[model samples]
Target: MKKLLFFIFLLLLFSCKKEIKETLDNNYYKKARICRDSKHSDSAFYYYNLAKNEYLKINDSLGVGNSLVNMALIQTDKGDFYGGIESSFEANKFLRRENDSIFRNRLATNYNNIGLAFHFLKDFEKSSFFYIKTLQYIDLTENKLLCYNNIGDVLISQQKYGLAKIYLEKAYLTQNSTTLSKVINNLAKAKYLDNKNYDPLPEFNRALKIREIQKDSIGLNSSYETLSTYYLDKDKNLSLLFAEKMLTEAIKNNSPDDRITALQRIITLDAKNYLNNFQHFNFINDSLQTARNKAKNQFAIVRYDVDQKNAKNQILIEKNFQQDIGIILLALALAITILWYIKRKKRLEQEKEIEVKNTQLKISKKVHDVVANGIYQVMTKIENQQHFNKDEALDELEFVYEKSRDISYEKTDTQGEEKDFSERISETVSSFKNDEVNTYLAGNDSGIWKHLSSKNKEEVYQIIRELLVNMKKHSKATIVSFRFERENDLIRIFYTDNGIGISGDVIYKNGLSSTVSRIETINGEIIFDTKIEKGLKITISFPAS
Candidate 1:
């Protein structure tokens, strides 16, 4: 008797649990539907997710699929195209093939939403495929028309006009006014695109008439754009008129994309008012980008908050497991701290050794570039000049000594340039010129150096000195040319010589490698041209910002 009583009690408990689960899932789903109908997308998404979890608890595949479909629709509408496609694919896993009309309809909707997401993302091929897939499960005429039109639109984007026209004609059989206008517009566009001689003006006007009569502001914007594009080459006045109308309609409908399209058209056709239209285009484009970024960020935050909330709820349900996890995590944290401390101690020792080695390397490079190169330049001057000035040679030696002293103090070489950087650069380049080598410079105006940073100027000075040093030592050049020009925001320096050029497999020695590093430090680029049969050519470019 006691066993029978205990069995009955267990059955009652299970029955109550099942009833409560079903009620919760049903209530959550209904609330989600209400939120969705009210256009509260974030709230609807949250409730749908909750209902989906409840449905999973009760093993109700249909309920789970329905909730996921709703969530995906919201995501797509909110411009989360990738997230929408992902959710639709997850829902497809639960929605199986069935004889029931409702089940097939749900499956069709899921595929259609995925197609729509792909269409927005501009994956025309995948979009066409999914739209075709949607047609296989779709039964309703209106839905079938939508899928057909979508496939046609995708084909048109892919420039397959003939195939696009066939599906568009099929969709045109629909009596729905909105769908009819959409299909007619696309079909006419496809025709006009396929044959330049084809006059789609009649059909375009017909669609425009319907949209205007129905007071469809969005549809009217599309019509204006189409008409403007059609008359762009034929009649500039008419194109500008239509483009202005489109801009007005777009502003009324609060559509940034249409506004941008209209602005572009206006700017192209109305060259007199180019600046005004271009400014408006820039503002609208920036605002649209910012808004889309904000919406995507909000969607991410909503998903994260929901997941965290669900996790906390689960943790609350398993308090004993939470205590065990906390203890294990604490132990892991302590062990990590001890290991990190030991690693940090070893890292510090290694870093000190590396610092000393780096300092030694820097000193050696400075000695080679400054002191050695300075002495070499003096020797070249004395050897090449018929009447070498002793005072000028002494001044050059003093400059080298000052540089060597500053290298020991780790001071920058860019300071004390109030005398003018351009003059210094010219003096350095001319100092290398003699009877044997004719070094010519062009476009070395002080204006070119105005926008360069001090550090960049210093690096450029060093790079030029290094190149001259390399030429004196390696290349037996007779003629050398240095061209300096400012191309918009970039400063370009061109160096060419008439000597034995480097082979394609030439390796960069210490001097060349240091030049490369200096260019990189200034966010500049260098190219060595070894294809020249005679002399080497190197071009350096950097931003003037």
Candidate 2:
């Protein structure tokens, strides 16, 4: 009983595995067929992905590559040129490793699909190259009729009507009835384009005969339409007859596109007729335009479908990228939060240290100014009493005592003791100037003093003082001029020096750097224009309001 149960279990397990593999293979082939029929190219891509994944799991490299090539065909049909190229290249890579004739022919089909895509893109050079390559692996006799027709179509689009006729003629000679009819129609058009007016009529007639024989209503409608166009200049009666025939066939076939073309031809021929046909012409023209618009809308829908599929793919990619970015951003935020907390803690500690240092500085300044000066003064007086040549020393001691007393008095008297900013600036400039460095000041207005806040006034004074000091020390200037002009809501300060001008390459250091920063502290634009042999001119403009 145990042995029988074991045998039954093994049979069931093997059957299940075979069924699963067969199911996967059948699904893959069915999906490929569906994709080819419906032109749902993105869906085709997804299915191709699934098919290739399953094939790879079974270690079928050739199957995987063939699946990729099939996906490339769908991409090419949907106008994804770059994608088609990439897919074709990937398929070729795998195909190179396989020495099978069938696989090589599959690679040729991929090349042909790529060529067709490029032809639609109007890249004739690349299209020709790949089309020629299609013949390398596949027998020309087997698929040459289709290949020749495509070559002729491309050539006709390129306006190579003469060469197009030869290829079309070759395609027309083929045994395939459908290819022969298409080739005949193309050959007729190529002949018309080539200015061989007599040659097109026979070709058009032959294509029409084939369509009639085959009972292809669509092809008959197309042939009649083209025949009507060819006879328009040569024979108006014949043209009108064919045009009416085309309209009848288009209506019978229930093809809006063909009906639209037929209506257009009828309308054109009606215009060239007598005034009695005017109303008919207008009616047909209106109907044709309306139909054309409808067709355009349909084309737009096709484009929209393609775009929607692409947008969905893009959304998938963007969603994945965003998830990754979100994770990275979360990590970055946590790291930054940690860094900020550490910095904040360090800053608080530094602030506490600064408070302690400030307290010590206040005590040290008091001791240096008051106690040290008082002790020196007392020592000088005692030396004078001893007649130790202390007269000159006593004068110096008295000056130090007076300075210390003023410091103490200033520290205590906090009422109306703030120095006038303009006066302070003037004194600093005066101290900086001498015979070697001449300083010129212009447009000093006392009203300008009242307009400034204490902080702004101090900043302005420091900026000016620092600039003058830099000019005296580094500029090597003989004459320095400062001009202040207040106009409207703007204040302009101009500083010019007849110095060996600084080059553009010169780097700012020390006081000059401080001056630049101070000017920037206020909302001002500083422009420095200098020349090698000329002078340096600095203009600062401040918005007064």
Candidate 3:
């Protein structure tokens, strides 16, 4: 079903491609988009500014706005979020009032870019606000669905699982393309996180299959990360496996943030092998720092250039308007503006050359940081670090070499000293006792720890963890209680919370779904009593063994 929808989406996306070129001569705008689609981002950036300069020469506000948007897209993709937002803001001045569908679409895209930048910056509320603004300007059904999915993503970040599902579901049903795979995946997550009984695996697999079919390297990287996050707590080997996949894709795209996340996951999960990966990690860290610093300075320079251009253009416009009151002055003013544009064209060519050279120089520095330092560290380790076994050192050097050519692991220390079952339970409950949720634990120290197997204790811990996650995400509960019961052969637990309970049927969100799955495997039975306004209560019984 999703494949069919995605096929439809491909047609629509391509239709836009055609229309995009049809409206322009074999012009810079068309060329820029073609280059962008083909992943020639540097060329795309250059062409977009060529388009912008052409528009400026004729005072074509709409053309200039579109060029700015295209440039903003390039900047955003390059991780220069602040520069992208600045371009978007400048584009907005020309885009805001135009009712043309194309203009409005640009407006929507600009807002979405702003929202994504803020999201990456961890300002989620502001991000959500911009996404809402995007919705207001969006006109097409396909674009609207994209916004819905994006808004759903924001809601998920806020832990509004139920509400996020509503938006995601709407997008899923209306989507004409497989791009809503993310929406489907997010919907599954909402179900699990809402602590309802749901199987999110099918949707996850479905999304993965779609990305693979599409050959979407970036989206595939995201799929790997998503799968890795889901498995991190459940299966270390599997988590590391997916994180490794993420690392491969991240390297292909030269995405440092993804590299860090993938490497951190691998390191935490594969501590036994950290010594093997140390030199490679140092190389990645140093290279990332260097690349980011260069990008920061480059964006700063671009912003300065843009500000100067806009200020000068405004001055010219004001002069032209004022001098138009006199015929002779107006003629001179027009000639002056024409001459200025001629000079600007030559200046723009020089600036473009400088920009390309600057980027190349930065690349050289990044290479030095990665290769030279990494090789030095590896040599020093082999010669001076005698504690590392010879075979292990050779293996580690090979690992670093592979990484130098391409791309990502981690183990987390326990948050504190490990405690037995009872103490762990107490700490878990108290952990959730923040200002919002007043929580109490009863019968926790009542010999429950003495008779249970470690497996049973772990299962119980996971169940409680899932319960707490549910409460925090969905219940909006202020007061919560946990009661434990023990008998000759059976263990019983009761959990209740005061919050907005299930609105309708309980289709089990993500965390609760897994909890249910685990309990079923243990031959445990659980029941929930929920009312719309009152709250929720759960009762569970499982074997002591």
Highest lDDT: give the candidate number. Answer: 1
Error of 1 at 471 (Å): 58
Query: How high a TM-score does candidate 3 get?
Result: 0.52
Over 4 Å off, model 2: 1-29, 34-42, 56-59, 78-86, 97-99, 195-197, 217-225, 235-545
Best-to-worst lDDT order = 1, 3, 2
lDDT tens digits by residue: candidate 1, 186-270: 8999999999989999999999999989887877887898899889889999999999999998888777878998999999998
Q: What is the TM-score of each candidate against the true structure?
A: 0.52, 0.41, 0.52
Q: What is the lDDT for 467 in model 2? A: 80
- How far is each candidate from the true structure, as Cα RMSD in Å? 17.1, 22.7, 31.9
Q: What is each predicted model's overall lDDT from 0 to 1?
A: 0.79, 0.66, 0.72
Per-candidate total of colliding backbone pairs: 0, 0, 21
Sort by TM-score, top down from the best: 3, 1, 2
lDDT of 2 by residue, 1-545 (tens): 01111211222233234333333454765686587568665566666666665665555656666677776665554445566676777677656743455565566676777677677567987876777676676544736666777778778777888889888777776887766877888887987898863577777889889989998786787688778878888898899889889778867865544655666677667766546445545665577557545544443344344433333233234466786886799899999999999999999889867965775577569769676966776686776676655676666665576566455533422222356655665666677678788787887666555566666665677678668767876788888888888887677889899887786656264336667787788777888786546778888887664
